[model samples]
Target: MFKEVLQQLGVKQNQSSAYHPQSQGALERFHQTLKSLLRAYCVELKGDWEEGLPWLMLAAREVVQDSLGFSPNQLVFGHKVRGPLALLHDGLKEVSDPPQGLLQYVEGFRRRLFLAGQMAKENLLNKQKKMKRLFDRNTESRVFCPGDQVLALLPLPTSPFCAKFLGPYTVVRQVSEQNYLISTPERKRHSQLCHVNLLKPFYSRFSESEKAPAAVAIASSVTEMAEDVKVPEDGILQPRLNNSETLKKLDEFVKHLPFKQRDELSSLISDFPMLFSDSPSRTNVIEHDIDVGDAKPIRQHFYRVSLEKQRHLESEIKYMIENNIAKPSFSSWASPCLLVGKPDGTYRFCTDYRKLNNITKPDSFPLPRMEDCVDAVGSALYVSKFDLLKGYWQVPLTTRAQEIASFITPSGLYSYSVMSFG
Candidate 1:
């Protein structure tokens, strides 16, 4: 059936020799890992594995591979998949203005991909060299030259043992380290590529007793080649918090402040760095409550989300739970959430509260206008501006408001413990 489909689609089907999965060892290893993940996720139950396969794939893609030192997603996409936690961490980074057009964006993406792929390739090569050295340890290399007689391990047609060393075939040439090309019958072409492990020295009965293991001259050379690939062991680099670096940047920022207030503000920031933390801060001073004023609760089903979007949503939900910003809820009011894409390629999580908003009672209290604030501040000696990080999150939510702001996703229903944008 597959062959017919391939033929119909004009696709050529090139397959490797049967029972030789080692030809594509990397693919086989991937299959093994994927199966292990699926089996573990099932918790010993066998059926319905496909249901969790997408999530398992996302998990695997996000994980850093030992050989490459990078997650597959990062190597391919030039960045790690971002959610709420990643978005918050991104704030700590100094980002430049993004490219202006499609061509510029493509150029930027191309540069990133090239750099990431080159680094990944270098890391993979380093790991391969280390593994090769470890594998060659204590193992002898059988170096063969052209015209050497050697017994090649071959599969038997019918015997107690499935295979036997049947050849005293002449060596065609040396390929690399322990691998060689062998002269074989036309029908035996497929098995002619032999490793040192599969070939043994062919000796006459008289010389069998006196012959030494393959040649010491070339064997030491192979070992030396293996050792030549040794790289210096790298130290584990732990990420240290650089308060000094933060303060240095802060000092640069405060240089723009008024001469008299600069020192006092700098001292305050140095003393209480926690006030400007990247993480959200909440206050007990104000607990906001949403009043529907006798209107019916709004319960809307979640919108359909793509697998990629769902993966991000799942990550955002996990972050919210860990930070105590949101929790599982059984609220009667349920609103759907949307992931709005930002210009910088990140997403903004928002709850669809239009239905709830229509029923919400509006506050009628009057407040001073911006003109009045400017007029009042005109008489002051100094004017300063304050900006809060995650301003909406700084305010707490009332218990009743939490239930009223519940939103649903594929994972389940959750409600915010603080104010959230719609």
Candidate 2:
């Protein structure tokens, strides 16, 4: 049945691969040209696609090809094909002989094809120009220099930097023309050289008002503005509050706490001193005359907690001891520390060497690429996942490197016992 169909279509017998539809480039090109002509003619006629198909077929049959030097219809039918009007205009047909008429028709078709090709080229060029303009308008070219303080934008949910924009990092070095090394107070060691585009300037003014209490002058300024403005029925004419004055009031409020409470709060404020403003009217004195009738005074005791984050240090030491992962000596000065909680509901220690990791040279290890994995897995496979608990702590830290393993905590400084992992 297939043979009969091929014979009816006048297809020649050829190698199976050569005749395969996928391998028939010429046939594919012909189909594409036919589709383009059908679409164009349909658009020109503003008619239904099905109604335009016959006319497109006729046009294609009459079209001349430079390579073949003849229309496909002429080659297939052994005669030139005519359009609808050719049969009705007998006089028009009589003026030219068969060969001469064919030549004129081919010439006319060739001219139209040339014009269409030119129009197509122009359309393509216009599209490319529009695309280039759009691209140029959207492309960002902002750049920064070394030593400039920048805020690094971090991905959620574990960013160590400000919960908002991560950094106020100083660009310490230029790792590449486009990448820079940045450091922050929280990050004791240098961070990985990051792309310049990832950073923006830290606008200190944005947070300045939040730090300190608004001044009396700010309050007076708002009051003055309020006094001058008339309140509108729609509340559209409401006066803006002076933020500086609000900050001053907040400062005054903080200064009235008792001495012990003030001391504790003061310690908290010390780290962010800019958050408070001085107020002459406020005092830190505690009133001792408060009645304690029939009530026994409770005694309070203070004990020093180790500021050194020992829990993290111990985890690192355990990892080093177990895995024997080779690492540099833990430097007391360089080791990064983190606070952890003890089993007894107290604080313990940990250290993060992420900054140090950034500086450490990366090993040239080969890993499987996604494409290779996809190919190897083919189209049918099930996958399972597992995780190692306390994976890093399972390894122990070297004894000589213990000093570098030291970390800072609220209580005191301490060293780690295990190899640490970021």
Candidate 3:
């Protein structure tokens, strides 16, 4: 029945030797782990195992497997499954607004899935290397050149008094590393190719006396290999500092900086490594409160854009929508968008909020003067500074403020979730 099913699917069946389950070691190990997990999850009765199986499977898929270095769901679906704990941690709310159209939603998911597949493939390769390193720690390379006489350990059962070693077989050729074709004394090819682990050097003079001991040594070596693989001395491999790719990249980047700047950066970073990050910091919430002070809402006329500017503005709107910086709005207030050209030949998306600012009263609290600020900083023993990528946009606006800050565009009316400069 299985063969018929495979034939229907056009898959060739290659069964491993049942006598040596180690041939399918990976699957066997997985089965063993699954049984252990099932046992832990099903603390009740063996008959109640079916009730907890689904939950156990979900937990298993969500966890990072040792061999793959990723959760099964992540590898298959290209994203981590959000559990109840994850939702709770994220405040039981969506991080960003969903795409406006069905087509856009599908495209976004597809793009993320493709990226996830690439990431999972890289992680799998790294994990395979790590596993191989531990497995090959005490393993020595063995090559059987043609014409080398070796004894093959057969799978046949024998009595306590009978000889276990098969024969002084001559190695015909090395089929591959760890596998060799063998022939009997009569130069007839053996039915099965012998693995290196079950083959030993055959001495003609001491053939009878040494055969048992040679077989014993081969068996012990195979057993040791299995033991070492199953239980590595080090549970987790530690990365070497000298072989760090990140440090190498950092060194290359530092070489491009000015001499004094590099020295100052090195000293500062060496003292405060956590201050450095590959990505910019995120602003999760608003840091200040703004009072419109009973200022009436202002609605500005729609700004005109050329055919080229329309496409650029549309692209910028898409970016803002995707990043959750802005969303589609239908509010009483509206401002016109102004495309300001930069010195670098790029356009900055801005809003004409001059009319709105004129009506809104300014905060009475004043900031410290330049001299006073300089004197206050001079008293400090150590000082460090960093710039926010988009300072104004980092400050989130209130829901009411967002409606009041609505802007008109060719695409539609939109409101900023964060504060924007005029």
Q: Quick one: best TM-score, which candidate?
A: 1
User: After TM-score superposition, what is the CA distance of residue 68 in candidate 3 from its true location, in Å?
Assistant: 3.4
Instruction: Rank candidates, TM-score, best first.
Output: 1, 3, 2
Winner on TM-score (1 vs 2): 1
**TM-score for each prediction?**
0.38, 0.23, 0.37
lDDT per residue for candidate 2 within 159-250, as digits (tens), equals 54333557678888776655667775575444645666666776676575678767655222232345444334443443432334544454
Q: Which residue runs does candidate 2 get wrong by more than 4 Å? A: 8-10, 13-22, 84-422
Displacement of residue 400 (Cα, Å) in model 1 is: 1.3
Q: What order do you get sorting by lDDT, best first? A: 1, 3, 2
Model 3: per-residue Cα lDDT over 141-183, one tens digit each: 7777898878877644435344356778788888766677788
TM-score, model 3 to reference = 0.37
Q: How many backbone clashes does every candidate have?
A: 0, 48, 0
Candidate 1, 203-254: lDDT as tens digits: 8675754576565552222222253343223433334334556666665556
Q: Rate the local accuracy (lDDT) of all candidates.
A: 0.80, 0.54, 0.73
Residue ranges of candidate 3 with Cα displaced over 4 Å: 1-25, 45-55, 80-101, 158-166, 183-190, 205-422
- The clash number for model 2 is 48
